[model samples]
Target: MQVVPARRGRAVRLARGQAIRIVNTHGSQVVDTWAFNADDPSEFMSMEHLHASLGSVFPKTGDALYTNRRRPILTLEEDTSPGRHDTVIAACDVHRYRSLGCTEYHDNCTDNLHAALAMIGFPRTETPSPLNLWMNIPVGPDGQITWGEPLSKPGDHVLLRAMIDCVVVMSTCPQDMIPINGANCLPVEVHYEVTG
Candidate 1:
């Protein structure tokens, strides 16, 4: 078990059949997560493939997260804060902050993801869309998405079991411009567990 500080990142390697539990320690915080084949970083989790295969926009227990090659990377085993995650949003980055009227440097999820990957010696590359855990962005009748306060509370967690050996990166989202993190960003914790 490891506690990932607010607006920071962490990386972990999971062997096949291992599992990771992501905790919203402070509640209402968003954690952006990415996964890739441990031996081949180029084959990363794919939001498109996952949605296509599951035929749903939100993740649920029993759903298998797919990789770029349409192979199962991880399976959703438990979701204490169920149905409150996002699979359609990309991680926040510098360009997004700039466009949002920020001129100075701001901590963003993209950099966090890259830093986490670098920690594990993975080369920098284009990041795939993240599986936003504990985020709340609902689509309205007009097909417009609006950010809302996360439904997750303190100590709430979701566990994902790895279907294949993989590298997982996580970013405690630092977006202070929206209500995604209840109007303030904070840290979270992660627990890596291996089962027989």
Candidate 2:
């Protein structure tokens, strides 16, 4: 198991047929996740395309996560949560923090993504809307969305299998302005491991 330290990010390269199991070590940490083709950075996983391909905003186990080119890049092979992963919320960034009234520099998922990729010697690419693992954004009947706490318990995990060779980035979202991580509004580390 590898630790994605609190308010930080990690990246791993997975070949086709391999899977990564991301564990919610503390139960409330929301991991903003993204995947890009190893051979083509422009072909990264896309939330808009995934919503259209799945005909829903929520992805569950057995779902094929699509990329910008409308092709499967990863598969949601296993989920131990309540199937509440979010596909609509954009990853938190400095701009978002500013909007939330932060005047100082804030750590965010957007920067984390770029840094993680760079650690692997990959050039920075456009930030795609991430698959927010364990993020609880409840959509009401009135078409309103409310930020909710995670329904997952400690040790809950989501296993994503790469359909093609790709680099998967995981960010331990640093959104302390909101209670999306938990009622305490604290961001924490999570863990993951690559599996055959």
Candidate 3:
């Protein structure tokens, strides 16, 4: 188990069949997460393929995260939260912060992902859309999405099993401009375990 400090990121290598559990150590925090094939970093987790294969934008237990090539990379094995996660939202970037009226440089998830990957010698590139764990983006009756508070409390977690050997990157989301994370950003914990 490792703790990823607030507004920071962590990278972990998971062998095939291993599991990574992300814990919301503080309630209402969102974790921006993505994964890449260990052998080929260019082939990263694809939200489009996952939604197409699962027929739902939100993942649940038994659902597999698909790659850009539509191959399984990880499987959603367990969730202790309210099961409201977002796949349509892109990771927060500097531009996004500026758009939100911030004139100064702000820590963003995109950069966090890149920084974490760089530690392991992975090339930096534009990241793919991430799986936002513990985030709440609710669709209204009219189909418009709005940000909401995370349903996960402290100690709540979601476990994902790697279907193939992969490198997972997670950003303790720093979007303080919005209500996501209860209007304040906080750290999360990552636990890597092998389940036989």
Candidate 4:
């Protein structure tokens, strides 16, 4: 595993067969994420469609992922690494910070994804939806949920093979919260290996 840096405001592209394993070197490191069809830049992801496409819930093993137009995007073909991943946790934005906590985290994944969206010229204004792949945030039986601790370990990661050429953008969460972003700033690693 490589602990590389995803500098703030930068975008990344992961080709087919190449999967990204976002590591929470410490724990509770929040990672806001997004995916798009590389061939069709205008075509992007919609959490609504994704959740519905997977049968009105966050994707699980063997779930069928579709694009904005309901075209096949990816299948949860494998999740052998991490024990859990949050599909509903929303990436915090400047507004959220001002209202919920701090405005300092405004330049995090949400902003980065928005910059990326504008750069790609994708018509998205409803706020960029990011999938928290490794951060530990869960809902309890009493309907009370807590976003704390770490879900995956040092080597635990998620592998995603693109059904089509796609753009993957991530924000190495800089939110230095005890329950989110690990309370300590650190780096992450990304790798791609050809399979198909």
Candidate 5:
């Protein structure tokens, strides 16, 4: 809760022993996140190990998150307001724009993710599965899924602590077709704190 304010078009970096909390201040903001080691760029985050650590799902508060080498990377230390954080959600990409009914969404979240990855010296991969922090996409009994109303109210946040010297970059999603981006498409604030 140190509240280091981050803005749009700029990326924030955090070191080991530091815990950061990001807020979806308005409502159901969608955040696409990635974690990597400051020591090595190749030491990336792996969803496979992440699934193994928390059973194929995204972590809530107190869940441990794993790295590509199966090492402890982050722990979901806090969730002030609960929402459906999507681990299985696909990142928006050009292919998604083409196939998922709109090419206009090209310069969206997936592109931002790729930009962030490339800024960190990683080759941008295609459509990485995302961890939708505050967005709500409900799955029905028939396995059909749809975006839901705003689950995170203003001042609601999720906190994460780095186990290693990890760099996290996020894109506050700007999709308008769904309720995934809080139904308003606003900005979010990310803060860092060294809490060893």
Candidate 6:
């Protein structure tokens, strides 16, 4: 298992048939995840497409995560949590922090994604909506959403298998201003490993 340090990110390469096990090591961290086709960075995982394909805002085990071009990119083969992962919220960025009253620079998932990909020599400029692992954004009957605390316990994991060769990026979201990470508003590290 590899550690995605608190408020940081990591990137990994995956071939078709391989799977990545993302562990909620701390139980409270929200790992913003994204995937892009290995041969074409422009083609990436799309949350909108996934919502349409799944016919629901929440993805569960055995669900195929789709891409912008309406093709399967990753499959959620397993999940060991309460199944409250979020699909509606956008990845937190500098603008988001500014709106939250931050005056100085803030660490965000957007920057983390770019930095992580660049580290792997797979630079990408677009910031697509991520599959927020363990995030809890409850939708009310009136269609309103509320930022809720994570429902996963420590050691919970989600296994995602690649449908094609791709680059997967994960950011341990650094949103200390909100309780999205948890009720304590703390950001922490998580672990992940690739398996055949």
- Return the lDDT, model 4, position 39: 68
lDDT of 5 at 54: 79
Of 2 and 3, which scores higher on TM-score? 2
Model 2 Cα lDDT, one tens digit per residue, 32-139:
999999999999999999999999999989999999999999999999988899999999999999999999999999999999999999878999999999999999
Q: Candidate 1's error at 171, in angstroms?
A: 0.2
How many backbone overlaps does candidate 5 show? 0
lDDT of each: 0.85, 0.96, 0.86, 0.59, 0.66, 0.95
lDDT of 2 at 141: 88
Q: Spell out the clash pairs found in candidate 4.
A: none
Q: Global CA lDDT of candidate 2, please? A: 0.96
- Candidate 6 Cα misplacement greater than 4 A, ranges: none
- Two-way lDDT contest, 5 vs 6, winner: 6
Better of 1 and 2 by lDDT: 2
Q: What is every candidate's alpha-carbon RMSD to the true fold?
A: 1.7, 0.6, 1.8, 3.8, 3.5, 0.6
Steric clash pairs (candidate 6):
none
Model 4: residues with Cα > 4 Å off, grouped in runs: 1-10, 14-28, 56-58, 101-105, 115-126, 141-143, 183-196
TM-score, cand. 3 vs. native: 0.93
TM-score against truth, every candidate = 0.94, 0.99, 0.93, 0.72, 0.79, 0.99
Each prediction's number of clashing residue pairs? 1, 0, 0, 0, 0, 0
